[model samples]
Target: MPGFLKAYVRWVDSANRAIGYAAMLLIFVMVGILIYSSIMKTVDIPPLWTLEMAQFALMAYFLLGGPYAMQMGAHVRMDLLYSTWSDRRKAQVDCFTIVFLLIYLGFLLYGGLSSTMYALEYDERSFSAWRPYMAPIKIIMTFGVFLMLLQTLSELIKDVAKLRGESLS
Candidate 1:
């Protein structure tokens, strides 16, 4: 592999690792918020934003950690037959599935970005009583999908390299 491509993949891997850790931290914070809210509720002092904040944290957690999941090969798929395939065959199958993943993620990223921009321009907010701005979550979604796209490109390169009998690692 060229030094540049190696650097790019390493950068992507690092970014995903950082994001994954952030997601883990978010989960802990969310749990704390819920626990505090529960304890406070017993004293009849429930926090109004706890649920809303939890929802936001959960959304960010799932979206931002997606690239890490992909890197770890944790996504669900039909693996019963795939597990028996050879490396080249696996690469071929991955190439086919990656095309579809890229297409779908492209559309998702576009839509999320558009919605986020619109929300920012119009000062959109949730309908809930707390009414937090929606743009931040949408922006995060768009960025998360963009990260996935980058990781997908890295995976594609690896698959193609494997198919061609080139050692990328």
Candidate 2:
């Protein structure tokens, strides 16, 4: 592999791995929020924001962890046939199939950005009782999608390198 491609793969993998590790903390945050909610309910002082905040935390966790999952090959796949394939055969198939993934991620990114822009432009707020401003979460979600797109490209590059009998790692 060329130096630039190798660097790109290394950088993206490092970044996603770091982000994913950080995002793991969100689960603890969510759990704490739920525990607080439970305690509040027991005291008859339930908070309106707890449920919504917990949901937001979960969204952040999933989105931010996605690219790392991809890089680590932790995402689920139907492996009845795939498990039996040689690494080179798998890379060949991956190189072809990744185009569909890239296309899907591109469309997802476009929609996410459009929705984020609309949220910012209108100062959108949730319809729930808490009625929190939507832009922050929208921005985060959009950023996550962008990261996933970059990671997908990195995966594609790695697949191509594998096909050429080269290692990007």
Candidate 3:
């Protein structure tokens, strides 16, 4: 079971990395197009939907990278007060924070899924001329939140192992 979980995390990590790169590429392309289109528009060329794509891609970028950020422990932390504590206390604090974070992220997971489902049910699309499906992006947020929850659980296990004087790695 542990091996399976380890494999699953590896797969999710790989998948999120791909998503991150794709979102980056999308953003780059949209920005380039926006510049070109704006220039052409000024010269009486046909207006384009660059702004639409850029907004969508930017949201996707944020949603997709969330899980990767949590896994890396690169998220911002204001631990100055906690850092003064002993090692055992630090572990205790981490465990407590992880519990709260788990709850908060679970809420996000639920909300994102609900929004995605609504979008799908209503066939919601962007108001822009491009009109891409919004449900997919919403669903991505849900997936990312789920990944983040897994990461929190992993952290909790690590902290618990530390409390037990065990190597979580």
Candidate 4:
């Protein structure tokens, strides 16, 4: 592989790792919020925004964690059939499926970004009492889709490289 391509892969890997770790941490934070909210409820205190906050955090976690999961080969797959395939065959199958992946990601990126723009233009906010702004979450979701697209490209490159007997692992 070219030095630049290798470096680009490394950069993507680092970014996905950072995003995934942060999302994992946010899951814990969300759990903590839920626990706190439960305690507050038991104590007769209003945890008015805890549910909203947790839902938002959960959305961020799932979106941001996507690329990382793909990078780590942790995403769901048909392992039973895949395990029987040879390396070259596996790479070919992955490459074939990647087209659909790219298509899906492209649509998701477009929709997320458009929604974010609409939210910003309209000054959209949650309907709940706390009424937090929605644009940030939409933006984050768009960013996540962008990152996933990058990761998909990296994977495609690696697959092609493998087929060429040049491992870019």
C-alpha RMSD by candidate, in order? 1.3, 0.7, 3.2, 1.3
Report the lDDT tens digits of candidate 3 across residue range 12-102. Answer: 6676666656655766766787787789888997555667666666766666666667666667878788768887787788998788898
RMSD of 1: 1.3
TM-score of each: 0.94, 0.98, 0.75, 0.94
**Best by the TM-score measure:** 2
- Across 92-115, the per-residue lDDT of candidate 2 in tens digits comes to 999899899989989999999999
* Whole-model lDDT values for every prediction: 0.89, 0.94, 0.73, 0.91
Arranged by lDDT with the best first, the candidates are 2, 4, 1, 3
Candidate 2 ranges with C-alpha deviation above 4 Å: none
- Candidates ranked by TM-score, best first? 2, 4, 1, 3
Off by over 4 Å in 4: none
Total backbone collisions for each predicted model: 0, 0, 0, 0
lDDT of 1 by residue, 1-169 (tens): 6788878888898899798878878888889889989999999998888999988888889889989888888988788999899999999999998999999999998888889889999999999888889988888888889999998988888888899898776
Q: Global lDDT for candidate 1? A: 0.89
Clashing residue pairs in candidate 1, if any? none
**Model 3, position 144: C-alpha lDDT score:** 67
